[model samples]
Target: MADLPRILVITDRTQVRTTVENVVRAVCKEAGCTWVLLRDRDLPPLERRRMAQRLREVTNECKAKLSISSDAQLAADVGAEGVHLQRVSDIDGVRALLPKGWIGVSAHSVAEVRLAKEEGADYVTLSPIFPTESKPGYGPPLGLETIREASAIGIPIFALGGITPRSGFSCVEAGAYGFAVMGTVMRASSPGKVIRDYAAAFATSSSRA
Candidate 1:
């Protein structure tokens, strides 16, 4: 809700959960990041719920929002900030499962962006502004032009996929509201420093506007 850079750091469940979660919480707290998207794929329902609960505890300490990628019901159960819907259909399902205050959607194209906005998403992730390893063979990356087009639709667009400290600011310049990074921050040798650099860049850009 502050006028700071909206940085959304995503957690990969494939990594060491406790270490990653702790590091991310620390980095976000220091950098004043807006939210952390906990993308735990394919875990059992109960385990996912537990992970969300733990993440909620850390995020609460940091005063940052935690958005779970799946299990909207579990997200609500654990008092998560929101749920990130991967598919369009999941949007309605999640909306119904979670409360009015908690819902986001992933958008790969302008159409999806419009649909997400129409579906009453809190924010939408528009991805592949650069080629990313996360979604192999998904399609060619939608460059900054697509992001500009989507952002013009008046919805808050979080640029995702292959976003790094170097490219993150450019995403904002291209009309994105923020940047969502997984490998860029999570896999960084010094995530704290990387987050600081990213925040600095976004702050500089914001000041020039």
Candidate 2:
């Protein structure tokens, strides 16, 4: 696969509908970060599908890939590009539910990452390269060394957790294939500019490397 973009914007419908979705979409578009993970833990099944469809419509306009979280069937039904499995156990089940071309799991630890790779995940997310607001009480952030170790496992690793526009480039420098964000963009004064800055920093680093 071509080098993925430096950012993956995750949208939780419960947390990111209304204004947040607009801001995130705008930011991801400007940054050329073309992958989004749409997640909503509170929505009813029907509502979740509806929201997924809406997200697909919005993301497609920017030519971004939309990956629904936890619901492979719904993702396929709504024409999403993939599904993000939160746990290793869900990997085979979700894979069997979707067709051949969709994306799969992202694990947080070395063992889980290995399992994800073994299970045929399209990519994996290793998190908390620094403290993050989205996941409180998830223990101290894993830091760059952990991310680098996980990245060496030979699967694409998207560094997640507490990754701000300022620290986003550090994740890339540490060998993360990309970064995934929730609060940084949602909480930004200008989400679009935040994305642009992160992307620019990653591009600059890429050129220097």
Q: Give one digit per residue, the lDDT tens place, for model 2 in 1-209.
A: 35455577887544443564586567767666687787666678887777788778878888888888888888888887788877767777776667564565766677877888877777888866677777787767888888778887788888888887677777888887877888777666677787787677577777989
Residues 1-209 of candidate 1 have per-residue lDDT tens digits of 23323777888756443476766776767666667877876778777777777888888887887778866877778787788887767777676667554577888899999988877777788977898876667678999999889988877888989887778778888998888887767766667777888776577787989
Cα error, residue 172 of model 1, in Å, equals: 1.0
Give the C-alpha lDDT of model 2: 0.75
Model 2, residue 173: distance off in Å is 1.5
Looking at model 2, the pairs that clash are: none
Model 1: how far residue 176 lies from native, Å:
0.3
TM-score of 2: 0.89
Per-candidate local distance difference test: 0.77, 0.75
Could you tell me the C-alpha RMSD of candidate 2 in Å? 2.1
Top lDDT prediction, candidate number: 1
